[model samples]
Target: MDILADIATTVLSQLQKPTLAFLLGGMMLAALGSKLEVPTPVYKFVVLLLLLKVGLGAGISIREADLVSLAVPAAAAALTGIAIVLLGSRSLARLRGVSPMDGMATVGLFGAVSASTLAAAMAMLDADGIAYEGFIGALYPFMDIAALVTAILMAKMAQARSRNVIPQNGAATMALGGTGSADNDGPSENRTLVRGILTDTLQSGAISALLLGIAIGVLGRPEAVYASFYEPLFRGLLSILMLVMGMEAWSRLSELRKVAHAYVLYGLSAPLVHGAIGFGLGMIAHQLTGFSAGGIVLLAVMAASSSDISGPPTMRGALPEANPSAYVGASTGLGTPVAILSIPLWIWLADLFIGL
Candidate 1:
């Protein structure tokens, strides 16, 4: 508990600020169209470690050295987590009457991931010598794509609602999706949606590294465990990822002043709700899917991670209505990890109660 508390304070207070600054700077440059960019290799490296850490951590925990035994649990867990995210988000959005964008933001968040948090958890799990599997991390990219697509659709819905209204400061130009100006003005957006997804799948570029990692794993190549080269590579990547992620966090916090209450509420509630839902979902999936307890636990963990990318940034970035960064920082930095750590203990208590 103390360790978790320390992580929460350190991550939210220290790390997040830096993450924000860097990302905001990068985004502004991208949006305003500054040529300055994080190096391609650097971006890829961070994302790679992000995937590796999660995969290795889970792989180390599963200890399926033969690679064959890993299949059942990984499959069961991934399917369960994805299903919960997809179905749960759509349901929640409709119920809340949140605009399509909000629903997408909410639901999309359920799929996007936090590479940093996953990396940290993986490292801890690795050090503890717990055997996990690659499949868990492999699923991350798909999760990302799902979230992004959903967000786009949601954004489109929100846009449709906006109709003919003139957005402040040529808002149409800044939006994504190769979208034309809302008032039919300015240069059109590059049709990156399908192209982006395809490029990611085929080229293994910055936005699609997770998919690359997944493909590598799916093809039965978890051999990185025995290889020594990946560790140094990961260390180099983590430093950059952490530094940039920290900068992004800093920038994100500045946005919080606009919607402090909603941010705090999301921060507080999301982790607990998501965690419980994940745990329950994992259990149910286990029974239905015939996966092991460890496998089920992993599924639950994935579900808890539903908010990884979308949930946090939504709170932190553009929309003041829901501060995703705070939600993520507070939850992932603190809530999810604590939840993961508590899971075994919780199960033990549950078993004890049942026995009594």
Candidate 2:
């Protein structure tokens, strides 16, 4: 009873926040076709600021954190993320009759983490006075990299398997050197592609901000760092960025109709499924690691959210056969809205799991 009441209050409090108000306002303006816009560079800067702030806060908290205890949850989060990617992609392909490449693309986008959703989760936690460990921010990269690799690999393997290699000449056939090495070569090229994709993901603005923030936070004293600009301006900047994100997400919603209903349904249901899995894993992790309920909640939300920022371009580059409209549309369109709306549900699930 208390849990439900607390969640109700928390939901109401979150709805009343200026940040969410800004988000809704941005969506409304976009809907009305208002010319107001945040410049591209400015928007990127805001995202960087929010990511770095979160990372730095996490780093400072790690000072007193137990490495072993943290490892348990981190490991669970990583495994759960990988499971989400594989299972989600396979299910989309099997259930939707989507081409293998397109399904992988969708999975890659949804399987990864969303920085905007992470910011929203942080905002929710603060509003609710939830206590979470600092190292939770570090889990984002692990999931991001894992999902990217899995998507690329799935695409490459499917492409290789689908090809019907035929020799046009006798000498050319002899040079073919059997299916073993040729098959080996495909996987090898995929590995190289995966490596390149990983490099790009790590070097992206979001990941870079997180890495830089962690470095600064780990080196400086927590009190001094929090008193500095990083702590003070984090939430306001996050809200503004989310407002822009909401506008961007709304713009993409029309693209949903460009694809099949299966993609749409998958996009809509992804957060709920992934969040439940994450929440379950987090509950098990709590028993093993004794991590805070807040960290568990963050982990669950992080797992639930899809990557709208880094996922599309990378997947398109790696899986050119896939329809860009389908992956990008489903992800930013149905998926983003579903993910944002699902934040409260994830928190409520966290409360149920953690007894908070």
Candidate 3:
């Protein structure tokens, strides 16, 4: 009875957040055909600030964490990201009859983490006075890059097998839906390709903020000054960001609706399935390492999120032949909202599993 009460309380409180309220408001206005808009630059700035603040805050907390404690969770988190991609890809391809390249793109998008979702999850944990491991944010890049690379490899292998050409240097001679080339561009091209992708991934505002925050947390003493600014201002920034996101999502509702019903199903189900799997895995990690309920919840949140900023561009660049609307619409349009909406449910699940 107490647990049920706690779940209800969590759900209500999460719904009442200013950030979530703004998100709903944005969606409502869009439905009403109001033309109010958040300037692109302004939205970008707020999102950047939000991510940086969260990352730095996490980093500060992470300094006291033992690497041994984080090792299993981090490894599990990365593997979970890969597993979700493989599952999403197979389901998209076999179930929906989507082409291999397009399925891989979907995998890439749904497999990676969403920075906004992470920020929102942390905010919820904080609001509820739940204590989570801050170093979980460090797993962000591992999961992000892992999903991208796996998707690329899957696409490469499928394309190669179709053409009966063994990939020489991997992803170098293989373009999506294009003939595999026998020419070895040598390792130089492969190295260059990896370098370029890394550069782009690292350049994302959220990622860069996380990385910078980690650096500061590890190397500097700005916690007192930084916390003063980040703690108080974080939710407000996230609120504005969510509002903009809601408006953007609402505007794209028509585009999302046009996606295949099968894909729509996949998008809706991916987060739920992945998040459940993630929570189960977190439970395993907890048994192994005695991690806190909040840390487990964070792991679950990481797995549940669908990528918004990082996954799409990589997919667009690699799988140009794929339908942009299908992947983008499915992930940003369906998956993200579902993940955000489901946070409370995950919290409840975490409690059941870990006794939070």
Q: Which candidate tops TM-score?
A: 3
- Which sequence of candidate numbers ranks them by TM-score, best first? 3, 2, 1
| Error of model 1, residue 42, in angstroms | 6.5
Candidate 1 lDDT tens digits, 219-321: 5556665266566566456546644543444344454454334433444455445555555654554465443444444444455554444344333343344
TM-score of 1: 0.54
Model 2: CA > 4 A from native: 1-10, 165-190, 219-226
Clash count, one per candidate: 45, 0, 0
Query: All models: lDDT?
Result: 0.46, 0.76, 0.76
Q: Give a tens-digit lDDT track for model 2, residues 25-127.
A: 7788889998888999898888877787778877777676778876788787777778887897669966655777788888888878888888788887887
**Model 3 regions more than 4 Å off:** 1-10, 167-196
Between prediction 1 and prediction 2, the one with superior TM-score is: 2
Clashing pairs in 3: none
TM-score of 2: 0.88
- TM-scores of all models? 0.54, 0.88, 0.89
